[model samples]
Target: MNNDEIKAALTSKSRSAKLERRGKIISFLCIALIVIAVFAIFAFVAVRGIATFVGTKVTLWNFLSKTAWAPGTTDASGVPKLGALPMITGSFGVTLLSALLATPFAIGAAVYMTEISPKWGEKILQPVIDLLVGIPSVVYGFIGLSVVVPFIRNTFGGTGFGILAGTFVLFVMILPTVTSMTISALKAVPRRYREASLALGATRWQTIYKVVLRSATPGILTGIVFGMARAFGEALAVQMVIGNAALMPKNLISPASTLTSVLTSGIGNTVMGSLENNALWTLALLLLLMSLAFNLLVRWIGNKGAMK
Candidate 1:
């Protein structure tokens, strides 16, 4: 090669290498910043949450087990009644009920899309599901307030705002997410698996239930866990429909409250650094930990799926 061409080639290589190094540095910085932010948040929440116990005299046992939640009032022992059992029960009740209600529908719709009618599922249902997911949470809450609350009040005979209403709202809110994930999972199944099942004299129903659904169990469970996490974390919508009553649920239609709802409603009213405010922070910390647990569960499920 001539000297001029060789010089140009060397310069080009040097510039490319410099650009690559800069890109790597930028990517690393972005990742490092994300990790640092996450840990900072965790630490901040932990400190604030622990302050409820450390800064005050509230014992962990009283906070967790007692049912009275009158955070502003003190009991005979001079400790504020800050029991979270009712909210905890309400949160779990709504999450589990909504998930149970949504799962069968989601699985059926997913199966229909993937196995029964691909064209319609793709062209029509997919967009509808996408639209449902795009709708704001407040809108869902409003609709629940206007429609579901009235229906429950008429049918079941109460204020209509309670765990049942919250469950119905969350069912609709989470259905699209679970259905879409199930569709993806089913689609991820190898076509050869289906053919193999069919060749073994399995009927379509058998192949689907015994093969496809079985193979997609991990992904389906992951989707359900994600839905449950969303349901558990939901605040504004749930607060609007859950009656904001900090009492243990007596029945599906009875007035109740969840942790997220109480936090949303009460956090604004309490002064910062007070027992009430710190208690709310403790709930926030619980939510953060639960979110982490959900993520860990998803990772575990993914690993198990991979091993299979």
Candidate 2:
């Protein structure tokens, strides 16, 4: 109403507007930086990956189909045998086996933590499980090399370093990830769902199986997919136990190699601009693509579950 009051109100309004504009600019700059970084990484990998084929006579079919992967050797006719099917199969075989072994146990533990032993889990078990995630991968590799390898060799026979060893180690590494995610997902389900099931005379077990788990399917699947992704890309522990043999896996107990193992092992052996080096780049590109595909699959599963 007075001139002094009018001036005070005008000053307050001006300060608020300036603060809002500054916040918006900061947020936009953060988002733009993230976009630039992601695109830069993709461009770098793409150029290096495609450069492998430049001036080389290898076909995509030969690279993917032939099982022999002798990057440093030539045939009797002096042609390099760059077939990658063995490594591809080894990667998928170990990853899938580890996932199969881990999923049911992870889900069951998640259910018990969230539904059955909420009090103890909240106070003790959950923190202990979360702590497992921070332990270095090399520590797990050491334990497997010392303890599991000898056990497998004594029990089953053969050099203990094989697919079975790799699977068991990866299974342990992925458990914490799957269990934490599943617990969070199960906990996200509305409490009313359980109450309504109980009102209908359903037992606690039936309510969990039919109502809680059904509603939390998306989260559970997302956790499993994430664990699989980690297993797929794992290099150190698997490489330590998998024997590093660049051949098709004959059986679960046979020595084998995965894509990551080959890359780490072969990178130092090849010259910078040689075909072998380029082929390794191609394998790196394939790994990146596989990770992207897993992410897309997770999004699709989540959207489908949300719709239901």
Candidate 3:
């Protein structure tokens, strides 16, 4: 090659190498920042959570076993009781029930959107669902209070501010997340899979039910996990309807408090350095742990699905 051509080629190579190095540095910096942020949050929460026990001398077993969570009240000995079993069960019950109620509707809506009505889904339904996601939690709470609470009270004959009210509110709140994610997952399934199934004499319904859904199972599960996480972490909307009673959930209609509700209601009222305050920190720590566990479970399920 001529000298000019050689110089041109060398300059281009130099520029490309610099660009590549810059991209790698940017990517590494982004990843490092994320790792540091996660570790920092965990450490901060952990120290505070442990301080509740270390500073107050309250046994972890007592925190777990006691059913009453009367942080404001004390017994004859003047020591506050900080049992969390009731709140723990309440959180689990509402989260699980909401997930159960939301999952089927989410999956069915996703299927219809992706497979049955793609045109209308793209033009109308998707935008509406997206709008639902942007609506504030407090708005949901207000709606539940005005509409769902009265309906439940009139129909079921309880106070209506209970687990059932919370469940209904959460069901609506989580629907958009689960439905949108599931639709994306279903859409990700290759068109050729459906074509092949139909070519093999499988009916349309059979192909969607067996071939498409099976292939999208992992993604659908990931969406469900996400929805459940949102449900678990929700505080304001649920707190508005659930009566915020720190008691074990007796039935669907019973007034109960989840961990988030208890934290939101009690944290502002407790004095710092008190056992009550520290116990609330412990509850925060438990919530963080639950979120981490759900994340790990999602990763595992995703990996397993990818392997299959």
Candidate 4:
């Protein structure tokens, strides 16, 4: 070959190799960016929620076991503690009550929409549910302030800041989450299961209850768990109606607060980097661990059920 042709061929091959190397580098950078982004997000969550100090001594277990959550106590005789039994109890109390109230209604509504309703009816009703979900949490808080608080206050003896008030509002908020999940789960159930049950002379209700519901139980449970998690994480509306009292609730009518509520209240209570600050940070870590453990438990149960 001529010198000119050989030189051109060599240059062309070099250009192709350089382009290939550039492509690999770009691909590697993209993957690295994604990995870093995910790690940073999770690391931030873990730091605030898991790494914060809840106890300086061997007091975390004691604090959780104690009923009173009085931090920064007034008297010199009485040592201040971060016992969070009240807030923990209040949060779970409201969450369980709200989920119980919301789940059945949401499931029934979802079933009706998916099974009984005509196309036009579904189109009408679904939007209303979606609209409810779309409403801001702050607006829900305002509604509790205007309507729910007064009703609870008048109907019961105490101020409208109690577990019942929070649970009531939370019930309304959680309905959308449960309903949407139920609809998706029920719709995902295999039609063959329902048909086989029907062919065996079962009524429509019987087939749905025995076969379709059972088959879709996994998804349904997932939805319920997710709804409960959302309710537990809720702060704005619950705090709005929950009276923000740091005491343990004696009755559903008594004003109460939760861990999130206490955290919010503590923001301006002390100097930054003080003991009180460290204690609250510790509490923050505890709360994060509690939530993470609950989510893991849900997944573990799901896996067990799937294995069966």
Candidate 5:
């Protein structure tokens, strides 16, 4: 090649390499910032949470197992009542109930979309599900407060703010999430699997039950876990409907409170360094841990499915 041409080619290569390196550096910096922010938050919450136990010398057993939760007041023994059992039970109650109520409907909708009527499901239901997912949490809370709460109060013979109301609201909110994930799972099944099942003299329903759903079981479970996590972490909606009373849930219609609801309600009322504040931070740490556990469960399910 001529001198001019060779020099031009070399210059172009050098510029391209510089741009690539710049892009890599930018991407790496962005990732690093995200990692640092996550760790910072975890560390801050942990320090504040542990301070409650460290400063007050509250036994972990009493904090987790006792029922009284008057963080601002001390009993006759001169110890703060920081029990979190009521909130823990309430959180689990709503999460499990809502997930159970939503799962069947989600699976049915997903089956219809992926197997029964793909054309109609794609054209109509997909947009509807997308719309549901996009609606804000506040709107859902308002609707629950206005509609579901009143209906329960009138029909169920109680004040209406309770676990049952929270369950209904959460059921609706998580339905779209579980449905979308199930659809993706069902669609991921190889077309050959369906064909082979059919060729083996299986009916469509049998094929779906024995093959498609069986294969998608792990994905469906992951979706349900995600839904449960969403329900567990929900604050404002549950707060509006759950009566805000930190008591053990007596029944579905009894007034109660979850960890998120209690945190949202009381966090602003306490001083920054008070026992009340530290107790709230501990609740926040518990929420973080539960979310982490849900993610780990999802990963385990995925790995098991892969191995199978």
Candidate 6:
């Protein structure tokens, strides 16, 4: 080809390449913008809720670890305590209860579904468990109210709505999530490993107990963490079964409110500036921090596993 013809073709190709790069850059920016927008909405809502409760200014020590938790007062020394310690304890208690209830069954279900189930178990039982995931939390609460509370009240007597009832409801609520995540995580482990273990004379149960479960530990823990987060946030269903009292529960059968239920029921009351209200926001910020920490930890752990 003549030099002029070659130059003309090269210019045309360069222009097309430039346009393609620009298109990709634009697409990437659009996706990033969408992600940022979503995070922004959550951030904005959380901040607004805090401001409505915490007021404009904040102190260093009080902001960090004050446990008093009463809201409202014009004075800086008015003692707008967050009562974060007890609330955190309660949240952890409930989460622990749910997590303990969930782990064994979820792991078993996942193991059976992937490692032990027959063809019919895989096809039929898997679908049923999957279906259970679609059930609403409120329905679970209703069931808890009708059968669980009555059982508790009848067996245990008065103060029927208590931590145990709420815990039971939470246990049921968190199960589907735990089981589904566990199943998916276990399934994600390499099939080749299982086969190799069998070739090496490892029994099916041993191969799973030793290799598959070990590899999927991080993923399974992630599911448990998610369950904890969900249980921490659960209010309506818990409130229905947990008595509305603010006092610390003496017994599993005694009535008491969770941190979530307290925040919900407290805000609308006339005690807007009460220590309780301010404490609620403080507890909220702590919860937000907790959730963020869990997500970050999950990411870090997942990345660490991937690196290995």
| lDDT of each residue in 177-264, candidate 1, tens digit only | 8998999899999999999999999999999999999999999999999999999999989998999999999999999999999998
Query: What's each prediction's TM-score?
Result: 0.95, 0.92, 0.90, 0.83, 0.95, 0.79
**Which residue pairs in model 5 clash with each other?**
none
Residue-pair clashes per prediction, in order, are 0, 0, 0, 2, 0, 10
Q: On residues 193-280, what C-alpha lDDT tens digit does candidate 4 reach at each position?
A: 7788888999989987888777778777877887888888888888898988878899998988887777877867966566566556
lDDT of each: 0.94, 0.88, 0.89, 0.79, 0.94, 0.75
Ten residues in sequence with the least summed lDDT for candidate 2: 51-60
List candidate 2 stretches off by more than 4 Å: 1-13, 76-79
RMSD (CA, Å), each prediction: 2.3, 2.8, 3.3, 4.1, 2.3, 4.0
Off by over 4 Å in 5: 1-13
The stretch of ten residues in a row with the least summed lDDT in candidate 6 is 79-88
Over the stretch 185-217, how does candidate 3's per-residue lDDT look in tens digits?
998999999999999999989999999999999
lDDT of 5 by residue, 143-170 (tens): 9999999999999988998999999999
Return the candidate ranking by TM-score, descending.
Answer: 1, 5, 2, 3, 4, 6
Error of 6 at 66 (Å): 7.4
lDDT of 2: 0.88
Supply candidate 6's per-residue lDDT for 216.
92
User: On residues 140-173, what C-alpha lDDT tens digit does candidate 6 reach at each position?
Assistant: 8899899899999999898578888888889888
**Deviation (Å) of 266 in candidate 2:** 2.0
Candidate 1 CA-lDDT value: 0.94
Q: How accurate is candidate 4 locally (lDDT)?
A: 0.79
Candidate 4 vs. truth: CA RMSD? Answer: 4.1
